[model samples]
Target: MTTLPTTIKRLVNHGPEDYRLETAALPQPGERELLVKIGACGICASDFHCYHGAPMFWGNETFPRYVKTPVVAGHEFYGEVVAAGPGAEEHFGVAPGDRAIAEQIVPCDKCRFCRSGQYWMCEKHDIYGFQAQDADGGMADYMLFKPTSRVHKIPQSLSLEECALIEPFACSVHAVNRASIEFNDVVVLAGAGTLGLGMVQAIRLKTPKKLIVIDTMPHRLALAKQLGADEVLNALDEDVVARVKAMTEGYGCDVYIEATGNPAAVNQGLQMVRKLGRFVEFSVFSRETSVDWSIIGDRKELDIRGAHLGPGCYETVIDLFHRGLMTAEGIVTHKFSLDNWQEAFKTFGTPEAVKVLLVPEAE
Candidate 1:
């Protein structure tokens, strides 16, 4: 076993664009808890929004602020279990040396939502990296997995790059599952970002008649094609709704999934989906998105479903990774040491970057 250190470096978020790298005492495993040594942590779109002082992160109209400052800031990560407190192995079915990843939210298992098997919407709603009382996130050398955390053991053969992507991939799986696509359905995915690309791959498995990806960036559109998108449309260069309508015989796409955080995509999805089609929304927006409610109710009678964190989908994502159905190639575009987080954050959301990751340990 590697000798554990008494102190470790971690990124602490004080507020929007007010984070700093600081050394803190190493976390000790409490009862039914585990000490995990973080290997890699992926920067999410929500992380970028928080960094830029988006109203959603800072609090504004339509939604109350959720981020609690002075908390460590990373949720999509995987690591090795270094130590386990008593009963942790029996409770979490994990032990020292095992590779594991925890779901982003640590639900209050006693809540009504939890009792009803909807823990993702637990009334307490404590997600890592945002809530201080929940376990601190994995943007550090080490982090803690609380007893209430939803932990999953992952295969060691998977690369750290693949492991870091599991979180977002699970989310995409949930989004795809929510759509409940049929064999002959024509599906349209908006925005070929990390989550959008993952959705393309996951939705392809359902054997949709046509899987179309829309994005402003040609590079991302090319990647979407490689990932099993039957058709790729440059929303910037083409009238996406017209192109989709032309392909679908003017009926529009059978399903439209909005993965882009941009509010404009909401209207695009509303416009492109056929009447009575399913529209799944999977992004955490930075601000309020105003759209015509009639598009959902009277105009189309569309089944608009909201997808939150990856609930009941993590195991499926890991299994898909093991079966080689999902991959990280060309998706995880950049890596940086934890020391270069500032530069990494800047690179994220840029045209050149897809999934940016921070490696805690030097390779």
Candidate 2:
């Protein structure tokens, strides 16, 4: 095992937009736990939301706070195993020098949701990076994987960025799975960001009749096409609802998946999905997203569904990456050293960037 450091670098979140790059005592692996060297951690949209003090993270009168203060803020991540505790080697299927990733949620295992095999919606709801004491995030030199963590081994053949991207892609896989698409159904994916682009390819594998992707940025739309989108629409220059309706002979799309965090996409999806059609939402919004409920009940009778964290889909995504079924080329567009986390977070979700990663060893 490598000699461990007494103190290591980490960015600790102290309220809104207040993350300090500082040193802290290094963590050690306990029984069935793991000590890992940070590889690359992807910055998620939720991180951006937390940074901006979204009520979901910071709390408001109506919504309970999710993020615990003084926490380590990152969930989309992976690392190299530096040491494995007793029983961890067999459980995680990894040892020193091996790479691995854990599911974002560290299930309590006794909760109602967890007991029912729906651990993603654990009542305790302690996800990595949000509850520092329970599961600190990977935006640091080293991090600990709790014993309750559901672990997966990462293939060495995959690129660091590809490995880091597994979390989001697994989420994309889950969202696509939620759509339950039929072979002949027309699918519309709103937003061509990392999540939406990922859905394009995943949805394509289902062989949808036509896959239309919408985004304002031309580059993202173009990349979506290469990723398997049959048709790409520039929402800036075209009427997305009209175009989709026209293409579908006025019935609207059969499946509409909203990956865009924008509130407008909610109503847009409602208007573009055919009556009794499926609507899947997988965005982490910082603010309220209001839409007319009558459109869901009185007018369309749409089947509304929400996709949460990646569940039972990580292994499939890993195999996909190994077989060249997936690529992070256009999706992972920016990398900044861990110390420059501010710039990394700032550059995320911009028009020119699709995904931004933080490399702990870069500095």
Candidate 3:
């Protein structure tokens, strides 16, 4: 075994226009945890929000100074177990060299919310990329996985690179599952980026009546059609609300998915959702904005739901990916090494890239 070092490679975000690669210390594993060597880590847009300090963070009020300093960031990842603490070996039934995806949030099992199975609502939650001080995240070569955290074994057939995408795909699974989309239910999806494309795949399993995808980007719209969207609408040229209404015979879609964090799209979702239809906010908007609540409540009676992250959908998604139900390669457009994280992050913002992933040094 390689002698564990005190520092690990990480991407540190001091502030906007202030991201740099640096080496940080590998955290010491606790009694009920294991040290994992990261193989891959998917760069999420949330990391962009943190890097730029745009959305201000959940605990921005508490830690004022650190916001300007370097903060280690990265959430979506897959790793191999290198060293296991006493209890973790018995719990996960995995040892050194076993591959696994660590849960973003390590729920405090003692909390009532956690005990009730709503672990996402746990007050004392330790987010892998965010809150935990001692729990250094996957941007490093190694990090600690708490015993209570959800850790699923990656299937033998699946590659470690693909495992990095399971988290986002799982997010789509959770959103679609919550939307209760049934067979032949007419659906209209907004945005054709990574999440939007993933939703298209998830909706296909239900065999929707006609999946209409709306996006301003032609490239993304084309990708959406490739993913089984029956119809694609260019939001820029065509009148989106009018086109959608025309397609559904003026009834509007049964389900409207607002995957773009744009405020205008949120209102558009309200307008496109049929009376008593479901509108799910699958995207996260950091800034506060105004919307037509009266139209939503009185006129449409729309069932709007906010999906934060995949709570328990990772295992199912991984299974689907392995069984050929989910396609990871199509969605993954660009790859970069940990040292080239800036390039990866830049590609993610580009119009051509769909899902940009950062390959770990170990891989």
Which candidate gets the maximum lDDT versus the true structure?
1
Instruction: Specify the poorest-scoring 10-residue window by lDDT in model 3.
Output: 59-68
Return the clash pairs for model 1, or none.
Answer: none
Q: Global lDDT for candidate 1?
A: 0.91
What is the TM-score of candidate 3?
0.92
Ordered by lDDT, highest first, the candidates read 1, 2, 3
* Residue pairs with backbone overlap in model 2: none
Cα lDDT tens digits for candidate 1, 1-363 = 689999998988899899899999999998999999998999999999988899877787767888887899999988999999989999999889899999999899999999999999999888888887475888899999989999999997788878999999999999999999999999999989988988989999999999999999989999999999989998889898999999999999999999998899999999999999999999988888999999899999999998998998899989989899999889999888889999999999899999999898754
TM-score of each: 0.98, 0.98, 0.92
TM-score of 1: 0.98
Clashing residue pairs in candidate 3 are 8-24
| Model 3: per-residue Cα lDDT over 54-125, one tens digit each | 544533453333232445667788888888887887787777778888778778889999999999767776
Which lDDT tens digits does candidate 2 get at residues 283-348?
988889889999999998999999998999999999999999888887888888878998998898
lDDT of 2: 0.90
Point out the higher-scoring one by lDDT: 1 or 2: 1
